[model samples]
Target: MRRKHTLAATAVAGILTVALGTSAAQAEVAADCGPGGPGEFANHTLLVFPGSHQPIYDFVNSAKRSIDLTMYELDDTTMEADLIAAVQRGVDVRVILDGRVGPGSKYYQPGYDKLKAGGVNVVWSNPAYYFTHQKTLTVDDRESLVMTGNLDSYYYNSDRDYALFDANPLDVRAIGQTFDADFADQAVTPSAGSGDLVWSPTTSEDRILDVINGAHRTLLVEQEEMYDTDVINALIAAAQRGVQVKLAIIEECDLYPYLNQLLAAGVQISLNNTSTDTLYSHAKVFVADYGQWDERAEVGSINISNTSLNENRELGVILDAFGPRNQQVLDTLDSVITGDFNDGQTYVATTDPSCG
Candidate 1:
């Protein structure tokens, strides 16, 4: 069990995104990573999900090797069905279901019992005050599908939801470490909660804001959901301080009621919604100072609210956004807020305004 590289870390949430451009400055020519292509999913050995990915669990059936499923709560029809089929074929399946899958909600107890009876390795994580909200699955640590939307049977078209499946090893390892850490610890603390993210959350929120506050050029963000006042305030400060701060949020429904407060705070806010496209813009990410000033950073997923911060579970990864490989990621992520979506669908404020 004690193997190479002990995973000491964690996952991301909604709006399936395929990032396209991000660099440090015009001074620094953008590093062109190769075309986007997925490595074989079969190459991945570890399969983990942050919260739930029941709808797409069927994709894992493509794997021919080992599969590990982490669930604070199971009984999702998609998971149950997939696991049953996999186990029947002698696939090595282990599930860590939440301890409270019975006598409560609609966590299909019959299915839960069946999985247990069938010898599926399962863990019951109860006494949980916070949610184990991770929905990720890794394949051999070679290919990864880190996503924001849950794998439930929601009436999802590409708009109300989004998930990203990439075959980049750098991205894979980062995501892999996250899963390893979550499953390693009986208690799962995300690498990044809702609004706050980065290497250390000892003062997680404060530390991250400190980094963002110092940015000189641009700050572009695309989060599936957000409602953190502290984060929004810090961003507003940066914008007022002359840093271009632009944010992309789910339209009308400011997941965090306090978000409107940022508009008046000078944080240029944009809605990632279309006129008739009232789908859930569930992807969360932030890209800053690519090819400008002297900083480059990108990160997010279901991060930016007390629910994800303290109530629900979540994850985030910040790469050297300037890395040659991350250009597309930087561009696509930034465009979500400033490109076509920015057409007259933004709110700009002069101070921290209140949303009623």
Candidate 2:
């Protein structure tokens, strides 16, 4: 029997349910999928582009089977043409974007419009001002590909951004939740397979903070932008209470005015050494002392930046798993956090009562 887990009541308040139609027999885990190495992507074919305008022609031409393209926008010539062509072929195509149908957007409802016209389901999940800054593609759901950078044409042609691919079982219920939610929810209604996947302009910040504050011990963070004094204070309290607190950051993220405020208050933080270029540790991950059990250890992309946390929309997956999977996921992230990452220069919060 396929058991169901009830997330915090907050997540279930308004979210709908999915009837698992695809059988468990279809789950084929490509051992290659995961981090660092070319993780498993479940599609037979994928063309990862960077930015709002990644190469579209090749993406279009490469559609040998059903495919899903993820990007923030789609206004590039090659992209438009490929999307148009794919729809005509009755390819089961879908798109997820950061913006909705409005002015000043690169590809709003137009992309959604054409896809729907071509019989493809499209969804947008960017929170308020924070652009939904994620680019991912899954072909046949049998293979999945998640990229760190956007797929714009110039970046592809210019050979910018990195792309990784691996195989994975498409039949998993939680993973399918990602695909299902992409189409079910409109721009306003956010859906989460497991509440672990935080989507914003909704309750992302609150839920994340709740998760952080609720932690019993050990909090490690690698944030490019840190502004909320409440979060800083919470971490400080955690530290004071003897919960190991460590923050790894890169100082040039544009939220410095507030970051400096935190710095002046004396928050112990470690800064990454990017040398000439700005230290770019753009991966957003958080792993607490919460021992993984029942697949609750999650790791995905949602940075603690102004855009990621409050202003721009963001997407992240909490890789919840059973004891084994949870251990693997949690241990890997913890290693990355506590290892040579902080370099001893991280800012530490002041012990003043106000700093609390």
Candidate 3:
């Protein structure tokens, strides 16, 4: 969607601190965002599909104590059944879905009914805002899966999407707390947890900008679209400071002005022709100073739009240069930046697709 407005800037907060639990061994971050697939299932795993559904099914099926899910869209019947089965097995299942939809509003009714009948607690998000667009899930209150796509089969089966599974107990507690607040339709401060699990209407812009500003050599980004003014400005500053910035995105109107500005400012910008990639360029990822000591990447449901950043509930995880998780995302983003990715003539300003 074309951006409706820009957010007032805020000071970047302190670094997020993760307190790992010693009761269970640390799980390796596993990611399958194409080219190279998911490596292993540890506390932190990133899974990409045509093969993503099985893990989600397994995650939900393995729920022994509780399952908390908040999604923008919910049309996947198989996964819906999995949630139901979890509930049948006595797992406390609760779901919060975005009530807002595009053309066909009744699309989610079937899935909702099935889950409700199967003993899951389902509710719509606070409709006062534009939409509750967060795609996050917590299991047994011990881990979370933050995603850039929906639970719908089409997304998992074909759309280029990314999912991060975090087993850090602190991360899970923060995400679970946010879910609890959203489920109750209450307001949240978005600062309860660390900075690594970036949240919208709060820290996404800062996290994104901080990564850009911290770049010493290079920056690689692949977003569905770019419209946030603060983020765009950070990219421009990075470019002006001689940071090699490369951005890959789908053709959309909301991003036209920013793309023009970035291009004029010497940032290497490219647009993805989704057809060539065999998947919609739907992943939202950022890698700053790739392969360097300060490398950082963020991948999740948050888009670079005002509505996404300020009004909607969105989630993404920041992968610092210290982890293997950063490698998988960096490799994928590098492909988009250096690949024959963008079309120069495909920008048309338009309204939000979800609104239309």
The candidates, ranked best first by lDDT, are 3, 1, 2
Q: How many steric clashes between backbone atoms does each model show? A: 59, 49, 8
Runs off by more than 4 Å, candidate 1: 1-59, 71-80, 97-103, 107-120, 124-129, 158-211, 251-257, 272-276, 291-300, 310-312, 322-324, 337-340, 343-356
lDDT of each: 0.49, 0.46, 0.68
For candidate 1, the 10 contiguous residues with the lowest summed lDDT are: 1-10
Error of 2 at 242 (Å): 2.4
After superposition, the stretches of candidate 2 with alpha carbons farther than 4 Å from their true spots are 1-65, 73-90, 97-130, 141-149, 152-188, 253-257, 260-267, 276-279, 290-298, 305-307, 310-312, 320-324, 343-356
| Residue-wise C-alpha lDDT for candidate 1, range 1-356, written one tens digit per residue | 01122211111122212332211231022111123234532221111122233324545565455456544334456667677677777767665443433324453356567777776655544334245555455544445555454444432344333344445566665555655655555454444422223422223355456557768887877665555667777787887888877776655443334456666656767664547544345555556686654555434334665555544444444544434344544454455445524653565432324533
Q: After superposition, how far is residue 92 of candidate 1 from its true place, in Å?
A: 2.4
Query: Who is ahead in TM-score, 1 or 3?
Result: 3
Best by the TM-score measure: 3
Task: Say what the RMSD of model 2 is.
Answer: 12.0
Q: Please identify model 3 stretches exceeding 4 Å from their true place.
A: 1-40, 50-52, 102-104, 192-194, 274-278, 323-356
Worst 10 residues of 2 by lDDT: 8-17
Q: Better model by lDDT, 2 or 3?
A: 3
